[model samples]
Target: MSRKTGTLLCLIAGSMMLIIGCSKSSEDRLTTPIPPSDCDTVNMTYSSDVQPILEANCYSCHGNGNVNGGVTLDSYTGVKLVADNGLLIGVITHAPGYPPMPDGGGKLSDCDINKIKDWINRGASNN
Candidate 1:
């Protein structure tokens, strides 16, 4: 082929490959499972399940010296207060009329929410 024709063919081939490579849907491109979280919602406990989630997601704003919205989650009694008043579920689940919690941190994972709900359903025990 002539030099110009050959260059044109190569550019066309490269463009086709680029288009095909970029056309894949995100899921199709991702071979590994997204996050692969194991959600165990059974037999939830305060020390093991609930408290840790609160510590990670809530304590920054609602624990220790910082008590936003007059809520403190540093103690079981404080946590229980919200749990009893339905504020725990309402805020975490981002239900209307209840402010979504963790504030700027966004909503908790579905697994974490389920664990908290299960704990509440089981009487929001101290255990």
Candidate 2:
């Protein structure tokens, strides 16, 4: 093969590999399983169970005045606003209405998401 032709072939192959590497679906990237919490059987309150999740993943923007979408998750009441607005649950569950939380972070484990749902279903109690 001529030098130019060989270089062209290598470039094509490299491009194909790049495309394939970047196209992995969300599930392909997730490795950790969300563990079941004691919050499941009983009420999952924001103060006890959900706050930590938000603190770890959401507090940066939502905690202070620079609230995204006018919503906050710093306090139980703040979290409840988004939860009642139906966006929190939707985002967490990857439902149709809103984009997922943490935008780029991997999806939360099923158990963790279920706890949020349970809290929402139970009226998003602060206690």
Candidate 3:
């Protein structure tokens, strides 16, 4: 192809790609995500939502009968004690006068933190 013709074809292809990219649906273009159903924190439950998160995150030092700092998170009653005393929120959120939990690990994801917070706010029930 002639150089000018080749260049014109390239430009046309690029323009079409640009148009396609900008034409994405609003859902596709969302600045804030539609929260995933996988992380459903709504009306958070202790056994289903809260406990799993703790089992994955907190159980290392506080589960399987491994009690650290007098905190045991392997079961509902243990978790309730921490939740009632405000230690759950304080430590997870790294509030002043409370030790940062996970000890050596990074802070829990905001979603996990929110889930625990929601569970705590919802009376920290065993159910």
Best by TM-score: 1
lDDT of 3 at 36: 66
Cα lDDT tens digits for candidate 3, 12-99? 9999988887876554768766666676677999988899889999898999878999899998889999899999999999999999
lDDT of 1 by residue, 36-76 (tens): 45788989999899999999999999987789999999899
Ranking by lDDT: 1, 3, 2
RMSD of each: 6.0, 12.2, 5.3
**lDDT of each residue in 1-127, candidate 2, tens digit only:** 9999999999999999888887665456675565545436357777777888888778887886658777788877888888898888888778876888777777887777877888889888877
Cα distance off (Å), candidate 3, residue 15? 11
Give the runs in model 3 whose Cα sits over 4 Å from its true position: 1-38
Worst 10 residues of 3 by lDDT: 24-33
- Greater TM-score among 2 and 3 belongs to 3
Quote the lDDT for 60 in model 2: 80
Span of 10 residues, lowest total lDDT, candidate 1:
24-33
Q: How many backbone clashes does candidate 3 have?
A: 0
Clashing pairs in 1: none
